[model samples]
Target: MTMQNPVRPLLTPLLAALVLAGCATAPPSLDKALPQTPAAFSEGGVPWTTAAPAEAQARGEWWKAFGDAQLDALVERAERGSTSIQVAAARLAQARAVLGATDANRALQVGLGAGASREAQRGLGVAPNTVLSAGAQLSYELDLFGRLAKASDAAALDVRSREALLRSTRLLVQAQIAQSYFALRALDAEQTLVHGTVEAYRDTLRLTERRYAAGDVAELDLVRVRSEVAATESEALALERQRAQLEHAIALLAGEPASGFRIAADDWRATPPQVPAGVPSTVLARRPDVSAAQSALLAAQARVGVAQAAWFPNLALTASGGFASSELSELFRSSARAWGIGALLSLPLLDGGRREAGVANARAELDAALAGYREQVLVAFKDVEDELAALRLLARQGDAQGQAVDAAARATTLSETRYRNGLVSQLELLDARRSELRNRREALQVRSAQYQSTVRLIRALGGGWGEAA
Candidate 1:
């Protein structure tokens, strides 16, 4: 008669459960947790033309749309040289290595050992004897509960999260460089305008002095013109100071020493890239931050599975084969050969609520990750909406500003002509000139804002490198 193992009945149910756990499921689809989004954005974006073939493939270097070669070179250099990018890359590499190590965990593990020992048995009246031994051991954790597998899956998701975060960091660095570069250019134009105004004021001052000397105008006119020239020159100096600061900021972003870096005065003419008529669904996928959050949530789910796995029994098999002998040379001899194999089954009878606490902690972490992911999605939608509204409103403001500048220019021309014909007072002519300068400067500011907003919107939509339309 065949005899059955006494524990067979008790183990049957656990073995069945372990088999069921092998079919572990991953986290649910992100769609179920995502907040509601509108089909169309509230603000219509800037009128952007369709991209050319070359432009469509430019990727993260969206600054190239501005057609500035210097900016392209700067962004490229930053991508390679910035410490921020380097740090993020290092983290991504570390996550990959961790995942690789975790994957390797789901395999047989072996260890080898050799040892020699001598023992003296004075009480037993035996002579001292020496023994030598050599052995190789093998052990494998039978992942019947899918515990190790779930841990590995969690690690893999972590790698994906890090990868997305790295991409997000790279996009942020590029956007910062573009915005700074554009701002510097705007300041350059402003300085040029200031310099011209200063020179024109100085020339007027000299003419007024001569006219006063010849009794063609009063001393008050010369004093007033001199004051205007002084103030204009002072404004030019301040503008140059601001330009230097912006240049320094750009150099730092490019990972260069500010003292050794300089961006010469250049024109700003970057046309905004086209916002493709894609809906919110695509944007969610393209945004790296959102992707990163989703990966984190998935990782959390995997961890919860790992924790739940602890409730199941653990199974391990271990084996060792070796030889032993009084003489080191005979350690591998057949006469001294020995081998052993064993299996272990562990079940938690009591753990003072540790396992339950672990499950609770894991569940809490999953909840937190889910909440965090939802927050990021909401923030992403808001970011896109905010930028669209800004661009739309800025476009309207720019149009009005342009009209104001044109009117001021016409008013200045008429006032100058009337002053030359002795039909307008010097105060009236000076006020008209200042108004034109102020209006022109304001218009340039509005244009700069438009370029900045365009860059912001591109970043909000996720850099051109991703699935962004």
Candidate 2:
């Protein structure tokens, strides 16, 4: 005990050194929270907007921005049924419960226990003795070294980080549902175009066969028309396959059997919902992933205090009060009462530099967390920038494709009229029909691309996952 006395005396000074070193390092303040300046695109004429959402806070239902009733229902279903979201929610709840438990009991700990025993001694005055005893134990750890405070702070930060992770998971699920829903609708548009093309090809084949029978066109023109019809039929089958696959994906997202679920075929239009791009600073707080990253940093920061607190001595007070008697009838009597109190001061002895190593590890972890946070912010900025660029470029392409479709439709009408009047060959009529079909298909693709791009933009903005359930 005397040899250990010297070791105990040096503990206070070491603890003081640790506390000073650990708490002194503050988290670096980030002024430029979000990235605003976008990378320049190769296409020189596209105007990229920097406007993000005006609301820095997240809303609950982000799918409503698409103005699609079906999409809104699907997102709701996904939120309710998604296993990943449920897991994340459960984790958040666990973290909150842990924080509550740590906070509520930090000041006091109490326990009650009872015991009964029988003892026999031949040499004693009484041949047999029986004792029954009950005791209440109370122990409280004084936060003299701020260890409990730091532990509570770390636990609270863990709750915040867990909540942020839940939000991030929700946002991801919403984005996937939106993207899949739009892609399924796009397939519908492609199927419609394919059917329309098949009809036009059939009509052209009929006209070509009639002219060939009347000696106005060769047999090869009739064969070419029939071949185009067959090809368009094949395109319709391929589109249907893609549509079914998308349907299955959506069903899986909603946590339902794909066999019984279906989305009705709907018209595809290029008018996607207009989302305002807010300032870059808003993205840091609004985006769930970014929020999660920052919360993780906060958690790491709190842990540094926890590590530093290990240097200080822990002060514990314990007391026990109980009633005891050898006779059952006298167990609760005043003469049978017994009480005691104790104070424990646990000072660390030499541990081969383990405490110092702990502080070093905590500092390293904090540095890594800070770096990871910065990386996430950079990735989020790039995501928004990429989506913004895609939207602008696709909008222009859709416009140009619309014009081409109109020109091809007019040209097809003129070619057919000329063929009927014997002013052009069957080849010219077939060419015009093919051109119209190609332009129409391109137009549908462009419209679909635009809608998909809008969905991407909403996802990058965190999809309003911050609402309370």
Candidate 3:
């Protein structure tokens, strides 16, 4: 007797053609370095530059840049306590696990199974028997078209990108915590200033009231002094509220309940950290966000190779072995062993443009990633330039404002002397007092702005806390 098969002959030539076609397409070479002349450098602004003392602080502990023990402790606590950082770390671990899974696919998969059964004899005289079977199977892809390699590469890149994302989250958390801490300190300073001003006004008001009672000054003068006292008291109250809000913000960043955490009221004498000069090219690597973007680009590039690889055939090797025995004791015996091996060829000969669309989409994604990477570099440059300009302009403004404050102080002293000699009215003396107060407040604001600008510069230069004077 002869048997005939229809499907076997039909499948042979198609599989052969797929294998032949796959061999024709070459594997792509992935360049680790980005293309020269990144899109970031094309647009002109302030040439990105860093300026700092030649002897710079270590980068490993950039937070020490501010040289504040309290700040250093706060940052370290925030890093450990932050829920957002934990989430990012978990995501990175998940990505690495996924990479491991993909890598496992590139190697052979082996499995073992076992089964046992007992049966009674039928009326037809079949014998009662216990049956036992054990089996082993193995399967693996040959990766003849580099498809597995590309997929594993893409997964690895994704893992790296997620790791970079975690780093970016850490950097963001550090900066936010520091800024909030500084803001809280600034508010504390402002409150102290307001309270002192209130005390001075209270003293002045008491003197005016006494003088008015003695018929030495008008009642209107006492009322004016009382009003200044009220205004300063109001500002002090507002500052207390503002400081509370800053405290709450800091607590949230530190992953603690606002009620559970409190910052001690230290005098706001801690100076902004000194910024270090980093190389322009180094900025691209130092900024966590930019590094994340670059990692994403690398991942996307790897995906392109994966998508392209799909256009080729998949080659696989399959093998299976099993043992069977009618008697339980015979299972896994030498006579029961068996094994076989075969190769498989698979190809997507025709789809409704699906494979082509995949390739196109992957290419588009690569383009987008490259563009985003370039954009990040450009933004990094702009941030540095903006801080540089701000530092320069603020220093000049601070100098001029200091001069104005000094002149107002002198004018206040002269006016006080004039009033004592009856050369000026009480109103003129009040006017001079008010002018000096306004000048002093403005000067304080200028100083705060200059300090904050320096802080911005330090962050832009990537850590190195400034020393306190």
Query: Using lDDT as the measure, which candidate wins?
Result: 1
- The lDDT values for all models are 0.82, 0.78, 0.73
Regions of model 2 farther than 4 Å from truth: 1-60, 121-126, 214-216, 277-281, 464-469
Task: Give one digit per residue, the lDDT tens place, for model 3 in 1-469.
Answer: 8787888886775677567555644335434433343433222232333333221223466656567888889989898899899999999999999999999998889999888898986797887787788888899989876778878888887777787677667767887887787777777777777787777678778777878899988888888888888887888899898888888888888898999889998876676654443233345535666667777887787787677777677778989999989877777699988778999877776789997798789889887887888777667666767776776677788788888878887987898788667787777777777777777777767667766666565555454333311
Per-model TM against the reference: 0.90, 0.86, 0.85
Best by TM-score: 1
Question: Model 3 clash pairs?
Answer: 65-464, 65-465, 65-466, 66-465, 66-466, 273-466, 274-466
> What is the RMSD of candidate 3?
5.3
RMSD score of candidate 2 (Å)? 4.5
True-vs-predicted CA distance for residue 139, candidate 1, Å: 0.8
Per-residue accuracy of model 1 over 1-469 as CA lDDT, tens digit each: 9999999988876876667566556556767777776655666643223222221122455677778888899999898888899999999999999998998878898999988899998889999999999999999999976799999999999998898888888889999999998888888889888888888788778778878989999988999998998898898888889989988888888889999998878766667665656533355656788888888999999998998888788889999999889997787779999999999988775799998899899989998999999999889878878877887788899999999999998998898889878898889989988998999899989889888888887888677634344
lDDT of 3 at 343: 91
Q: What is the RMSD of candidate 1?
A: 4.3
Model 2: how far residue 283 lies from native, Å: 2.0
